[model samples]
Target: MCGIIGVFGNDNAGRLAAVGLFAEQHRGQESCGMAVSDGLLIRLHKKMGLVKEVFHEEQLNALPGKIAIGHVRYPTKGSATEFNTQPHLVETLSGPCYALASNGDIVNYAQVRKMLENEKVYFKSDNDAELLVKYIAYRILHYKENIGDAIRNLMRDIKGAYSSVLCTPTELYMFRDPYSIRPMIWGKTPEGTVIVASESCALDTLGVQDRKEVPPAGIIKVSDSKIEVLDNDPNLYREGNCEKHCIFEQIYFSRPDSFHFGENVYAVREKIGAALALQDEGLNPDLVVPVPDSSNFIGLGYANQNGIPLSLGLIRNHYIGRTFIKPEQAVRDESVRQKFNVLPNFFNGKRIVLIDDSIVRGTTIRKIVRLIKDAGAAEIHLRIGSPQIKHSCYYGIDTPTTEELIANRRTLEEIREITGVDSLKHLPLTDLKTCVHCPENYCYACFDGNYPVGVPDVYN
Candidate 1:
C-alpha cells in the first residue's frame, strides 16, 4: 500500500505537501516524494527514505508553487529503489501532466507491460507507477478533447484496484477503481483550499473539514472555483455489486484515527474485539494484552467490554526495518525476538489473552506465543481481530499463496495446538461486515475467496 496527497492553492505547496505526507507516513515508509506546479514548470523532489529524512526545510522551501502533489510509497510489487518513487511527471502530447500517486496494485500489470513492450514502448524501470503514467499519456494522445473521456477510456483497458490522484496545471483530480479496494478521501479547509489524500487522517492533520469518500469507479475534479463529479460508470452504484474495499485497511493498514466509508477505524477495531470476546465466551483469561502497535485498539475494546484488565505486556522495538535481516528461516526466527520484548512481571503467573490483527503464515504468531509462554504465563488465549486469511491479496498486500496460508489447511483447534496456546479465537467472516459498520460496502475477499478485481495469471 501507499499514501497520496494533492493540494491546490497556497504558495507553500511543497511545505503543505510535506505536512500531508508526514501525516500519512504510516501508510508507506520506504520512499517519499513531492512535485509542485508553478503554472510554467513542475519542480520535483523525491528520495528513498522516510518523510523527515527525505524532505528538509531547504528542499521544501526551494520548490515554489501554489499547487502540489506528494506520495509516500511502500514497496509491495516493485523493488524498493529511488527510481520507483512516485509523483512521476509525464510530458505527454496533451501538455505536461503529473500522475501524482496511487494506493492499490494493478493485477494486470504484467500483461499491460508486455503489450506496451510489443509495440516498442521502452520503459525506464519495472515499477507499475511508470506504466500507469505511460498508459495515461498514450490515451491522452488519442482523446484530448476532454480529460475525463480519456481517463474513462483508459480505465476500460486496465483491471485491478486503484485509488489515485492526478494533477494538471489547472485542476486536481481523484480516481477510484470500480471496486474501491483502497481508501481515498477529499476535504477542504475553511478558506476553500482543496486537498485529497489516501486517508482522512492527513486532512485532520491539515485542519481540513472531512469530505465524503471518492465513490467507487468515480472521479472528482477540482478547479479554482468549481468541483465536478465525473461518473464514467454509474452501474457501479448498484447495491451489493460494488467492488470490495480492502479489508486489511481496517485491520492493520489504516491509521486508527481515520474513517473510511463513514466508519471510524478505531470503532471498527473495537467492534472486532467485542466479536472476538463473544465468539470465545469460554476463555476467561485474567488479562487482555495487546501485541502492541496494530492490535492495541482492539485489545482495549475487548478488555473494556469483557471487564478484563488491559495490560501492555509486550513492547515492540520501533526501530525495526522491513528488511532489517534476510528472509532466511533462522534470521526470521531471530528477528522476532529482537523486535518484541515481553514484560515478565505482568505476564508471569497470569492467564493472558493475547490479541493480534491477523495470522498470515502463522510463523510470527507461533514465535510470539512461545515468547509469552517462556515468560511464565499460566495460560495463553489467542484472539485475532479479523477472520482467517485463507486467500492471497492481489491488490498490493504481500500475502503468500493459498498453500502457504495456515488457515487454508488447518482448523482453529489445530492452529491452537500448533501455537501452544491454551485456546484460540478468530472473528468469523460474517462478523467482519458488522465490525466495519458497512455490511455491503467493504471487501472481505481475503477471507471469503471472492475477489472484486480479476486476479492476474502471473504477478511479480
Candidate 2:
C-alpha cells in the first residue's frame, strides 16, 4: 500500500506536500518523494526512507513550484529500492509528464510489462508505477488528444484496483480505478488550492475545505483557474462493474479518524465488537485490552458494547520496525519482548479480553496471549475484529499463503489451543459485512474467497 498527495496553485507546494505526506506516513514508510513543477521544469526530490527522514527544510525549499506531488510508499508489489521510489517522472514526446503515486495492485502488470518488453520498451526499474506511466504515455502518444481523453482511453485497457494522481508541468490529474479498491479524495482549500490525497485526514491536516471523494473511474483535472470532471466511463457505477473494495482497509489499513463510505471507522469497529460479544455467549471478560495501536479502536468497540473496562495492558515500543531480521528463535523471542512490554498492573487478577484486528499466522497472537497469561490474568479471551483471513491477497496486501494462514487449517477451538488462550472467538464473516456500512462495496475475498476481480492464473 502507498499514500499519494498532489496540490495545484499553492505557493509553497513542496512544503505543503511534505505536511500532507507526513499525515499519511503510516500508509507507507519504505520510501518518500516529492516533485514540484516550476512551469517549465519538474524539480524532483526523492529518497529511500520515511517522509521525515527524506525531506527536510532545505530539501523542500530546493524543490520549488506552484504545483507539487508527493508519495510515501510501502513495498507490497515491488522490491524496496531507491529506483522503485515514486513520484515517477518520464519525458514523453509530447511533454514532460510525471505520475505522483498510485495505490492498489494491477493484476495485469505481468501481461502489460511483457507486451511492452516485446516492443523493446525498456524500463529503468521493476516498479509497477513505471509500467503504468508508460502505458498512459503510450495512450497519449497513440491518441494524440488532450490529457483527459488519453486517460479515459487508458482506463479501458487497464484492470485491477488503482487510485492514483498524475501531474504535468501545467496541470494536475487524479483518477480512481473502476473498482475503487483504494481510497482517493479531492478537496479545495479556502485559499483556492486544489488537493488530492489517499485519505481525507491529509486534507484535514492542511485545513483544506470543500472536500469530495474522487468518484470511481472518474477523472479530475486542475489547470490554473480551470477545474474539469471527465466521465467517459459511467458504467462503473451501473452495478456489478467490480468486486467489493478491499475490506481490510477498514479492519487494519485506514486510520481510525478516517471515514470509509460515509461510516466512521471507529464506529464500525465497535459494531464488530458488539457482534463478537453476541457470537461468543460463553466468554464474559472483566476488561478489554487491545494489542496496541491498530487494534485500539476495535478494542474500544468491544469494551463499550460489553460494558467492560478498557485498559492499556500492552505497551508497544514505537521504535521497532514492522519486521526485523533475527538469526535464531532466542533472538526472535527477545525482539518480541522488546517490541511490546506488558503493563502488569492492568492484567493483575483480571479476566482480560484481548482484542486484535486479525490473526494472520497466529505467531504474534500466540506470543501476546502468553505474555498476558503470565502477567496474572485469570483468563485470556481473544476476540478478532474481522473474520478469518483464509486466502492470500493479490490486490496489494502482503499476506501469507493459504497453507500459512492459521485459519485455513484450524478451527476456533484449535486456534485457541495453539495460542494457549483460555477461549477464542472470531468475528463471523456475515457480521464483517455489517462492520462497513457499504457491504456491497467491499471485497471480502480474503475472508470469504469471493474475488471481485478475476483470480490470477499463477495463484490458481
Candidate 3:
C-alpha cells in the first residue's frame, strides 16, 4: 500500500501536503511526489526517495499553488524507480491537466491497459496511478464527461482497492473503490482549507477538523465555490453490501495512532493481543517481549491479560526501514541485522514470550529468535497477533505469490521449527473476528483464501 494526500484552498499547499505525507511515511518509503496547481497550471515534482529527501524546503517552495495532491509509494504494481513514482500528471493540448495519486493496487491493470492501448492511449509508466489518471482523462476528453462522471465510470469498471485523490487546475477530488479495502479520510482545517489523506493521522497532523472517511464508492469534490460529497451505493459495484476493509491494516500497516474502518487501530491490535493470550491459558513466561514498534501494543495487551511484566528487550534502530517491505530477499536479510538488537543481560535464564504482528516469509522472526536464543533465553514462545497468512493479497499488500508465504509453504510445526522457537501459535481466524466491531465488514482473504474481490486470473 501507499499514502495519498490532497490539499485545497491553501497558498502553501505544497508545504502542507509535504507535512501530511511525512506523517504517512510509514505507509510507503520508496518514493514520494506532489502536484501543485495555482489555478492556471499544475506543477509536478516526484523523486525516488523518502518524503523528506524528495520534498525538501527548496522543492516545496518551487511548487507554489492553492491546490496540491501528493503520494508516498511502496512498489506494488510497478518496479521501484522514479518513473513509477506517483502523483502522475496528464497534460493535454486542449489545456485540461489532471494529476492523480492512489493507495491500492489494481487487479485488472493488464486487461484495462491493453484496452486503453487499443484505443491509442500512450503510456509512460506501468503504475496503477498512471492508468487511473489516463483512464479518467480519456473519458473527459472523448466522452465529454465531467471529472466526477469519469471517476464514477472508473469505479464501476476498475476492480481493485483504490483510495485516490485527483487534482486539476481549479479543483481537487477524492474517491475510493467499491470495497473500500483501503482507508481514505478527509476534513477541513479551521481556516477552511480542505484536506484528504489515506489515513486520519495525516489529516490530524495538518490541523484538519470534522474528519470523516471518504465513504465506500464515494466521491468528494472541493473547489473555491463549494464542497460536494457524492456518496454512491457500494453494493452496485461490489458483491455484498458490507464494506471489506483489509483486516491486515489493524494487525500491521497502519500507524496505531490512526483510526479507520469504524475502529481505533491500536485498540484492535490490543484486542488481537488479548485474543492471542486467551489461547495460551496454561503456559506462563517470565516476561512478554514484543519485536519492537508494530508489535508493542499487542505485547501490551498480552502482558496485561496474562499478568506478566512487559519488557522492551529488543531495541530497534530508527534509521532502518521495515524489513518486510524491502523489495529483495537479500536486502531484507541484511536489514534484519541492522534493524534490531537484544538488550544486554536481559534474556539470561528467562522464559520469554515473544510477540510479533505476523510472520509472512518467516525470515525476520527467525533471525529475531536466533538473537534471543544467543542471549541465553530459557525459552521463546512465539505468538502472532494475526492469523496465518496462507494466501496472496492482491488488493494492496505486496504478497503477490502464495509460495512466498511461510504458512503456505510449511505446516505449523514446521514453522515453529524453522523459527527456532520452543512453541508457536497464531491468533485464530474466529478469535480475530471477535476483536473487531464489525467482523463482517473486514476481509480475511489472506488467512482463509476467501477473496471478496476475485484475485487476478494469473493467480487463479
Model 3 misplaced regions, further than 4 Å: none
Mind giving the per-residue lDDT tens digits that candidate 3 earns over 47-153? 99889999888888899999999999888888899999998999999757999999998888888999899999999999999999999999999898998889989
Estimate every model's Cα lDDT from 0 to 1: 0.79, 0.79, 0.92
TM, every model: 0.92, 0.93, 0.99
TM-score of 2: 0.93
Q: How high is the lDDT of residue 194 in model 1?
A: 85
Query: 410-451 in candidate 1: lDDT tens per residue?
Result: 998899999999888888888767786567676777888777
Residue 315 shift from truth in candidate 3, angstroms: 0.6
TM-score, cand. 3 vs. native: 0.99
Cα error, candidate 3, residue 380 (Å): 0.3
Best-to-worst lDDT order: 3, 1, 2
Over all chains combined, what TM-score does candidate 1 have?
Answer: 0.92
The residue pairs in collision within model 1 are 179-243
Compared with the true structure, the alpha-carbon lDDT of candidate 1 equals 0.79
